[model samples]
Target: MTWKLGLYALAATVAAAPALAQDAKTLAIVVKGLDNPFFEQINLGCQKWLADNPGSEYECLYTGPASSADEAGEVQIVDDLISAGVAAIAISPSNAPAMANRIRQMAPSLPIMTIDADFLEADRDLRKTYLGTDNYLMGVKMAEEAAKLKPEGGSVCLQLGNVAADNINARAQGFRDTASGEKGIERLTGQKGWTEVEGCPVFTNDQADLANQQMSDVFTANPDLDAFILIGGWAQFAPQAYAQVTDQVMDKLKSKDLIIIAGDTLPPQTQAFRDGRSHAQVGQRPFEMGLRAPDVMLQLLKGETVEDPLYTGLDVCNQDDPGFCKDN
Candidate 1:
């Protein structure tokens, strides 16, 4: 079940956080935020597993900060969850470094793993395992899709979720490397004919409306921009705002004059692509992450080793493909 943490619980000490139904060992899926639909899919997967194994000894507890950008708040939630004596935790780590530091402080009291996002390589020993997308490769596929749409390589804008998120950073680096045809270039500005427009690569902090506004503002200011890459689906998460913003550039989208290769093919995002608002999408399987994480954590609790990074894989849909996310 989801966390019923009220404001008082959040504002008060860790003791204030409810430790409900201790009889059933808690297999918690603590995500970056409870708001993002991508994470919701993860929650649903956890719930689905619970429903399937009704007689199981463990319960899936999904909790997180209300706001995606609240890095400190996410850490606090993790602290509370650990104090509540949950059997295991699968953290998405909104801020990877902060979470890793916190994990270090606790020193692996209970089985801990990362889901969707992971800690840096130097600090990965803090978690038993990581279960999620190959973020860098996800970014590589994103760039590949954009390149397919706009082969000549022109001015581009990257929409990032969190500045400190290792996953997002990896995706950004992957995009830069692939798009520029230069491995490990810091920023994209006219390398191998691909350039990151001035004031581009706006960090959305995982705020949907603001991401849409930033996208609108960036595209409005730079109408000549050839490609827009959303490394996360922040803007598209708010479908109405995304629609309103992209409507202004419908002509360009229609003629393939501009390409928007976004990450995450949630229902709304997929629909947006079908509606011609976005050109392509590279999606991460959060549901699969959620579905498998509990088992992974349970195995860890049993002192069984799991894969270091268990990749759930990705799904790609492009403008040229008419059979994207459709049943035969």
Candidate 2:
């Protein structure tokens, strides 16, 4: 059959019959790292959106950096869901290039949508639609915010997702370009850390935490370290962790102040502010994106041709911003 015909058949097969039946139809969500509240929040947002839509179902599955899944987990989940005949698969790919082939292998009779993060060199031909923030721009915004906070400039650290992931790479590049261009900013590399207590497998949450701990040590080793910026959730938990380290380092330093900044927004980061742990966060509207993603996916499943790209929003949350007391 023609590609166009195949695409139609795929969307129709999912949207028609039980896929569009009176009861809810499943939209399998495959995501990275359920270790933190960030994923939980995103899941809640997606669920809320699906709930509002009604007659739609969702199942949450973790495709973390563990041995069981990793990128393979996401690919398998999509494949399994397709085989089980779910209405749609809304994925936040763990590794895009590695998983793209598996995603593309899905029967042309299935509707697939991506959100939160994207696959490397995604087959736009295979996906019904995509909904997420401009990750690179968000990174630039974070760097700009850090520059504003520290005019003199200093070393900034990156707490990344997966190094191979396209979205994180883009964000890191944007941050590196912006900070390196600044007269005084220096970019610091992150330490590989574990997320869980046991630290069995390396994950973003672990990497983020390790990045924070390394920054703390940097501050201890070099008391003059001026500013530290983390472009991941690491900064959210770093304040308390660093506060302890900073308190120890401060006793021996003439100048003991360090500025902390982060990229993504999470509830813990906001809480850190309440306890005086963080300075600022570059917030992505994940909840809003969640609500919108399903709407976009539903349209695609129904065979309504959508625009090539869709916008999910973002903003900066700081002490000055209203998110101070409100959940970020």
Give the candidate number with the greatest TM-score: 1
Which structure among the candidates has the greatest lDDT? 1
Where does model 1 exceed 4 Å of error? 1-22
Lowest summed-lDDT stretch of 10 residues in model 2?
191-200
Task: Please list the residue runs of candidate 2 whose C-alpha ends up more than 4 Å from where it truly belongs after superposition.
Answer: 1-24, 54-69, 122-125, 181-212, 220-222, 235-257, 319-328
Clashes of each: 0, 6
Candidate 2 lDDT over 1-328, as tens digits, reads: 1212222334443244232344446666666555544555555555455434445454322233333225566577667777877777777776776667776665755777777777665465667666777887887877776666666555444556566676666676677666666322233332111011112112253344565566556555555555555656653544566456545544432232555566665655666555455566776655555556666766777799887556576767665674533543
lDDT of candidate 1 over 168-228, digit per residue (tens): 9999999999988888888987876789899978999999999999988998899888999
Global lDDT of model 1: 0.83
- CA lDDT of 268 in candidate 2? 57
